[model samples]
Target: MTSSSRRVVVAINPAASFGLGSEVGPALVTTLRGLGHEVTSLTEPDFAQLLDATRAALREKPDALVVGGGDGMVNLGVTALEGTRIPLGIVPSGTGNDMARGLSIPIGDTEAAITALTAALHRPPRVIDAGRIAFDGGRARFACILAAGFDALVNERANRMRWPRGRSRYTIALLIELARLRPIEYRLTLDGVEHVERALLVAVANNLSFGGGMKVAPDASLDDGLFDVVLVRPLGRLAFLRIYPRVFAGTHVTDSRVVVHRAREVRIEAAGVVAYADGERIAPLPVDIHMQEGSLRVLA
Candidate 1:
């Protein structure tokens, strides 16, 4: 869409990135408006309210929906605009802007991200695959990783923390969760084939990175129409710690305990495990996750 004809809605979660949204959200509005595009800026008290407001904004059939938060916010946009004509854009204003990292959007640099978004607006939206998780009564859309086991627990713990704000809080929470790490028994069905394994974590990745550039599925692709099923088998605490750092570089996939499978659908069954997608709680285990190619149109 061209600048003059573009009707853009920029939704900001004020609490995201430890309150970075309060500034970045308005800047995005100014930048888009200054470019002569019609822009609507929105901010809400929390994610649920933001989701509702974003859905309302989508009803207007805006040319694009720009989100000013991390992957969780992008996931919210995926929910609101996936399979619709509206293309989603990212501002990467969150603690773990993993979705931006996966999309190669500038992270922690607001100006660069804005510049990228503006440039992308002048071109066609990039079509990419999206993940869906269906449970007993509901389903959710994710643009990045869907994780269960240890890391999901870390996400759970971090969500409950109110002190020591910002990334350090997640560091503290991660160390705490790591101390309690143990093998989890999971029954996984990949593309209809069943397997039972005791693992520390399993990630169904639609993109290459999550957890702030951790290459959980380093070889994964958004247009491949498949999920990279990453499984980390049980390992000793020290060994797991040794491999943990390798995940940042994506070399951990070479470990003997690490197994990568490519599939179009996955069914996960594990006791007492909660699933987290795009760093937000999705639901409990026993969920069916599948991939849909070209399900999302993204601006860069």
Candidate 2:
């Protein structure tokens, strides 16, 4: 069947991008229906409600599930759609639609994204790897990158801020966290081999970028079946700040302070460090992350 005649369920986070969902959600429904596809548009009160609604929608067996939000919405969609055959569609309308950016989905332009997604859905869904995280009691899956140590701290702080809206909130939160940067004691076991170090940041990447297009792992590939584990060793405040700009251009991978490794399964443990992936907090450190090859099917 052609994509235009298929059934689609669009789940939107009303709070995404601080409120973009309120408009984007209705637009998606209208667009999808206008294309002659049957669309179910959902706007939930919160993340849990969104997840539950999307999960329920999946049981109806729609041709695809399109998310109209950011990376966090994609992460939630992945958690609900993983191991299933339905293709995931993205409309980037959030603070950091890095997953959309990494997947080459048009960012910030909802019409362009919808056009791209509609075209992509006409073909086979592109298979991509996803990171499965296992912690003390529970587990979760992330579609983009998993971050620990200093980056996670920044995410924690950014999520707590009320003033200074938009990206400036994150910048302020990053500065606040940067002022207190310190080496974290890390014990990492990658593919059964153990290594310990004092690192400032550790990122396990499936796609190439995160945090609104910061190319923390420039050489990462979503279908490679391996993770690009980028580690930044402890650096003084001035040097660390100097390397910050390089991350936006993804040049930090070549720096002397950065180390890159490839592994299928990794066990990470860092004292007092939390883990954040796709702009959502997963859990504290001591989580085992593994690359699940071809686990995600993206319409992009």
- Lowest summed lDDT window (length 10), candidate 2: 14-23
lDDT, candidates in the order shown: 0.89, 0.88
RMSD of candidate 1 to the true fold?
1.9
The sequence of per-residue lDDT tens digits that candidate 2 reaches over residues 149-244 is 788988788888998877898889889988998999999999999999889999999988987889999999889999999999999999998998
* Candidate 2 residue spans exceeding 4 A from truth: 1-4, 16-21, 161-167
Output the TM-score of candidate 1: 0.94
Error of 1 at 208 (Å): 1.0
Look at candidate 1 and tell me the lDDT of residue 133.
90
**Clash pairs for candidate 2:** none
lDDT of 1 by residue, 1-300 (tens): 463558899988757534555678878889988888898888888888888898888888888999988777888899988668788999988878888887889988899999999999879999999988999789998989999989998878888899887788889998998898899999999999999999999999998888888999999999999999999999988998999999999999989899999999999999988999988888888999988888899999
Best by lDDT: 1
lDDT of 1 at 262: 95
| TM-score against truth, every candidate | 0.94, 0.95
Q: Native-vs-model 2 lDDT?
A: 0.88
